[model samples]
Target: MSIDQHGDHVLQGMSIRKLPKVSLHDHLDGGVRPATIVELADQVGLEVPEDTADDLADWIAERSDSGSLVEYLKTFDLTVGVMQTREGLTRVAREFVEDLAADGVIYGEVRWAPEQHLSGGLSLEEVVEAVQDGIEEGEDAAEQAGHDIRVGQLITAMRHTDRSLEIARLAVEWRERGAVGFDIAGPEDGFLPSRHREAFDYLASEFFPVTVHAGEAAGLDSIRSALLDGRALRLGHGVRIAEDLDVVSRAGDEVLVQFGDLARWVRDREIPLELSPSSNLQTGAISAWGEELADHPFDLLYQLGFSVTVNVDNRTMSRTSLTRELALLAETFEYDLDDLEVFQLNAAAGAFLPVEEREELIELIGEGFER
Candidate 1:
């Protein structure tokens, strides 16, 4: 049951890394390899805080562990700095998929803000194409290595920015090519999904899928806006939805609770909550409850019949993987293999893929767990 340096472990005599998993909340800019950053930065003549890859990893880890969203976001400046050009974007996207495959992720949605990558004179279309090219190359490489993996782009728009409508159009334009869904990331406190009403309306008209970043830095109001305005099929780190629950009584193995209308509807509808244990702790998303992983309302949400899916919101910054997130949860909550498998199934069901494809992913997970 001991985890290795790579955040992999054996559970019940099975390698956790070998289990089939789905990644729905992974971010492209957040998962850049430190070595790739160094090389790309050198090519672009961009200065980096750390020269060597190992030191650079340590540097990112320290900066992200600051427990402030603003401080954690600063680390992205370096990664985004190197990703402005087409080649840089392509290489990083390719490596992103490769890393996901190595971590045993069978399906992944790589979310990145296309507007951020267009700062180097590239058009939004060009940025999406570059990332698609990289993703295809990475898929080919994984197939050649005897591992099967597939990834899709979750075209994201910065919440504080005003280009969401443009980003939404870009996402729909590339829907047939590689873009699977749309998202609004960046700061969440002052910004609400309602700010992008036009974009969400456009997406809804086109029947495009969306997942909003809400209930993380914000609260129930944000989640409400995401579902009502953004038409979000899933919630990004919707951990704060726990605030709507009132623990009336607690017994040894049973607890009585009352849920607000929003919480009840979300749970009844089974809107998936992309919960990242480590990132929530680091970003203080779950601070209202406590400062520890066990204090996270993940177990409560799961027990309360919510569609709770575990994720690595940012692998590089958080220094985690899907396997590691699952392992950590298992240790904290004394979860077994069945619990891990249920999380994977939830993610698969909530993926932006077609229903048939999602069913296939579920079958894969079932087989993997059975093995």
Candidate 2:
């Protein structure tokens, strides 16, 4: 069951990468190809730590595995440095879709803070348009290559910044174009979703979908704020919500547990948790549980009936893909093909697309798995 260097494995006489999957928590800046970064940086006069793509990949992996969120975030500085221009943004966005399509992703949402990319004299609208252009090109390229993939933008705002309301407006502006939803992506500990109540309120008024990065760097209170203030349709790495559950006892396969009010609400409401296994381990998001992949409460949440969907929070940083994340969870929890299919279905259901498109995605997943 050893996964290859490409983050793929053979399971049940099928290749994991060939299975239809939905990506709901991927970050546009976090999943750039190191080689593309190097080339783009050279053209843009940006300095990179490593000259070669392989070395740059190793460099990102090292920095991300440093067990410090700040250190991990520093890698983004280099990636984003090369992505300030319209050409850079479009190229990255296009490559992101191609990568997902190659990984057998049928539907994906690429989230990034537009405010972060405006440093190079590009307007908010311009940045979104560039990314949208890239996404469409990527889709056309994938179709030509005999791989069908559809990706949308999840225009995100920095939680610690003051531009959330503005960013939310930008997302709404592009909803009919390529933007499918809105999100808040920076530090989540001190900057709870409540801080962006105005933006969330506006998004809710417009009937735009929202997802918040909660319960990852923070805890249950953050999750509460995401629901009450952010109106998050889904939780971004909401793994820490398990903290609210009290394990009373365990007898063989049955474990008795009591859920707090917040936990009960999240579970009963079936808010999808974007559980990223490798990223959670690298970022120490699951430190309270333990320090290994097996320590993640993903299986617990899944068993307890949380809408647990697997995701690759940052492919480059975590050195993972959807195939890799699913393989890690399957290996850690001894999950079979059915478990993997269930996770894909959960992601498809939680996607920001309309109900009809979601059902189409579900059908695609079912057919892919059946093959």
Candidate 3:
């Protein structure tokens, strides 16, 4: 039951890293390898705070652990700065997928804003194409290494800007190419999903999948807006929905709870909650619950029959992988292999893939866990 240095743990005499997993809430801009950043920054003549990749990685982890969203977000400026060109974007995308495969991810959806990467004079379409090329290459590489993996794009738009509609169109335009869904990221408190009603309306008209970053920096009102206005199929870090629940009582292995209307609707509808343990603790997303992984409402939501899935929201910034996140959760919650399998099943269902593909992923997970 001990986790090794690579964040792997043995549960039921099985290595967690060997289990097939699905990643839904991963971010492309935030998961870039520090070594790649250093190399790409060097090519672009962008000065970096740390010269070596190891030091740069430590710097990112330290800044992201500052417990403030603004301070945590500053680490992205460096990663995104190195991701402005075709080469940089392609390399980052390829390595992102490779790393996921190494961590036993059979499928993943990488989210990033195209508008942010256009600073290098590349068109929106060009950036998508570049990332797609990298994804394909990474898949091929992983296959050659005997690991089967597939990844799709979740085109995102900045919430504080006016480019949501444009980004939504870009996502739809490339739907057949690589895009699988649409999302809005960047500061969450004041920016409700309703702010981009036009984009959501268009996506609804087109019958495209959408997931909104709500309930992380905001509360029930934001979650309500995401479901009502944005028609979000899933909620990003929807951990704050716990605020609507009133813990009436608790005893050993038993607890009683009263749910508010908002909480009841979300729980009854089984909306997926992409809960990132390390990132949630660092961002204070679950501050009310407690300061450690033990305090996360993940188990509460799960025990209540909510579709709670594990995620590595930003791997590099949080210095984590899907394997690490799962291992940490298991260690904190004293979860067995069955518990780990359920998390993967929940993530597979939450993925933006077609039903047939998702069912296939579920089968893969079941078979892998059985073995």
Candidate 4:
């Protein structure tokens, strides 16, 4: 199981890039192409750290590979800086979906904070509309290119800010349009979901889908608040839930473990854990387990019956795609075609689409894997 220069792998005589996939935890700002960034910055006269696209890509990858979550987040300032205008927002959003489609993603939910893009004089409603327009255009373009893809917006609010309730309303207001869910992102250590109880309550009352960024920058307590306060349907990079598992013994493929009450509930309830491999290691989300990709508890949670799904989290920042992430995991874990199919199935099941749509996605994944 060796990954190629293009970040693709051949397993069971199949190219991993050709398989249908679902992306759940991708970020809009973080997935901006370096070349696009350079061009956009030039249009706005924003001074970038690197002049060329390749150099800029290297700079972002180097900066984001730092082990501190706060340091990892700083790379976004540059991206958000370039995305202040409606044209910037629309282009970035369109390219985001096109890139996902090229990567074989049949379904994806792109999350972004609308407030961060208001510096160019656009209101929250205008920004959301701009993104949605781009999404539709991207979908049409992908269709013309022989790829059928659908993308939904997970309107996000910065947890450090005080406009979560307003953002929640915005998300629900766009639910019939392109919005699919609501999320709260930003520093997670001090700003727990409990701080945004009002917004979560409103989302709950409106029956809007919610997925919180928990158990990534913080620990189990943060996950608890995300579940209890935010009523999250899925967890974004909820890799730290492994802290609750007491590995009693292990031998080859079999292991005995003690599950804490929280772990038990999450596993029993089938709450999806959006686990990103490279990003998790870079942000120290799995540092307690080890410093390598193999050290990630994703396999452990999967073996214990947790609904674990693979994610990229941030593509450009981590310099990864869903295919690359899956290839890396397959190479590390020695997984086969069947194992890869299972990960896609997990993602399809956890998508915030309607039951019939999710079932259709499952069927499509099954057919693609069977081929």
Candidate 5:
């Protein structure tokens, strides 16, 4: 199987982009389109690194590819800068959904921090309402374009901030409107999920779904805190959870390993790990293992019955889509259509939706893969 320049892959004599998929770790700010960024920046007198969309796209890819923390962070600065108003938020959200639908993502959870978009004087409730409006518009547009897609909001709070309890309450308040879950994003190391224990405790009381950004920039302790304190229903790029595994021996495809108590618990509990392949490499989340997709412990976790779901952590920065991530994984791991379908099934099951809707997504994946 070969992936085209457009990121489309022909696997098992079928277009990988045509297969129904579910995305659980996609970031709204991290996935903005270059053209949209340029236009929005112009409206706000924001100086962008590039003038044209193509140049801006290349600029983003270059900076992200640098693998420097400074460069990677600069990308977010640009995305978050233009998304400060109701108009910007709604348009970006709509485009996000449209892009996901075009990429064959039937269902997705868009995670972003409302606190980041409040620089324009928008209230928490106002920002959530604006995003929901855009989501509805995007869904209608996708349906009219002959694609059915659904995206829910995963309202996130920055870990470095102290307003998590407030953010958690905001998420729960908007639960029926658009917010489907809560999350703590931002620098993962130094700041553990336990730091937001009050927020987690309140979310638990409200019976809200939470997914913490752990095991990405940090290690085992972060994952443990995410599970025990945050009560995370899913993990955001929990790639480093492999740190808990001791690979005893490996002979070709045959291998033996000992699992740590945390690893065993996570695996046994079937907790979903939202693993983003290219982003994992770009962020050095799997630096301990190796510097390539082949080195990712995704296949290991999958083979061991860990609910591993593929994701595109940042579409613009990594210059990736869910289809491309899956294609890269397939090329690296020699995964077939069945394996891809299983990843999608895992994401659908791990979604913050209720059981009935998740079952519909599972059925859709099975049917799509059958074709």
Candidate 6:
């Protein structure tokens, strides 16, 4: 099985890109097309590092591959800078959904922080509405193109900011208007989910779905805070939870392991880990394991009974898609079509959609894979 230039591989005589998939950890700003960024930046009179879209994409990718989350996050400045207006936000959101559909995503949840896009004088509600408009348009366009896709918004707040409570309110207010969930992204080391307990408490009171960025840049303590304080239904790149696992021994397809309480609870409860292979490597989230895709603890966590899901945390930064991430994992771990299907199933189950909707997505995935 050989992967093509687009990171597509044929397994069992089927192209990975044609398989139905679910995306739960995708970021809206992080997935913007470089061409769109260049065009939007020009309209807004913002200076970009590169003039052409291809060169700009290469610039962003090279800078983002710095292997440090802080430095990697700095790349967002350009994306967010261009997305401060209604038109910019809507266009980006629309293109994001369209890209997901083209990649064979049947269902996706797009996460982006509203606070970061308010610099253009748009209100919080306005930005959410803008993105919603784009999502609807993208969905319609994809349907016209014979690719049925649905995307929901995960209204996110920057972890280092004090707007969590406000953003929680914004997300809940727009719950019926395409907002599906809430999240806290940005730096994770210094800002624990506990810092936003008030916001989490409000969300819990309102019964809003929440996912926290934890166990990536930090370790078990961050994961604990996310579960205990943020009431996270899913963990964003919770790869570092592997730190709690003590690998006693290893053999071909069999390994002895000692699990700490945190690891045991997370595994036993089957908390979904949004593992982004290429993004995890670029951001140094899985540095403890190694510097390559093969070093990811994804196989270990999967074998240990953890609900592991594949994702493209940032498509532009990582230069990946769900198809590519799955293909890379299959190539690295020798996974078969069945394994790829399981990852999609995990994502469907962990999606911020209603149970019936999730079940429907699972059925769609099954049928697609069967075909």
The residue-by-residue lDDT of candidate 6 on 1-371, one tens digit each, is 44432567788899899999999999998999999999999999999999999999899999999899999999999999999999999999999989999898999999999999989999999999999999999999999999999999999999998999999999999999899999999999989999999999999999999999999888899999999999899999999999999999989778999999988988888889988888889989999989988899999999898999999999988788888888888889999999999999999999988899999999999998999
Give each model's whole-structure lDDT. Answer: 0.94, 0.91, 0.91, 0.94, 0.91, 0.93
Please give, for residues 156-259, the per-residue lDDT of candidate 2 as tens digits. 99999899999999999998998999999887778899999999999999999999999988898899999999999899999999999998998998999899
Segments in model 6 whose C-alpha atoms lie over 4 Å from true places: 1-7
Residue-level lDDT tens digits of model 3 in 1-371: 44432577777899889999999999998899988989999999999999999999988898899877768888899999998999888989999989999999999999999999988999999999999999999999999999999999999999999999999999999999999999999999899999999999999999999999999878888899999999999998999999999999999889899999988998888788888888998888888888878999988888988889999999989988888888888888889999999989988998998999999999999999999
lDDT of 3: 0.91
Clashes of 6: 0
Candidate 5 residue runs with Cα over 4 Å from true position: 1-5, 68-71
Model 1 Cα displacement at 132 (Å)?
Answer: 0.3
Q: Output the TM-score of candidate 4.
A: 0.98
List, residue by residue over 158-231, the lDDT tens digit for candidate 4: 99999999999999999999999999999999999999999999999999999999999999999999999999
> In model 3, which residue pairs have backbone atoms overlapping below 3 Å?
none
Clashes of each: 0, 0, 0, 0, 0, 0
lDDT of 6 at 153: 95
lDDT tens string, model 5, 1-371?
Answer: 45532478888998988899998998999989999999999999899988999999998888887544345766899999999999999999999999999899999999999999888999989999999999999999999999999999999999999999999999999999889999998888899999999999999999999999999888999999999999998888888889999989999988798999999998999899999888888777888888877888999999888999999889999888988988988888999999999999989998999999999999999999998
Any runs in candidate 1 off by more than 4 Å, and if so which? 1-5
Superposed Cα RMSD, model 2:
1.0
Tell how far residue 172 is off in model 4, in angstroms.
0.5
Q: Assess every candidate by TM-score.
A: 0.98, 0.98, 0.98, 0.98, 0.98, 0.98
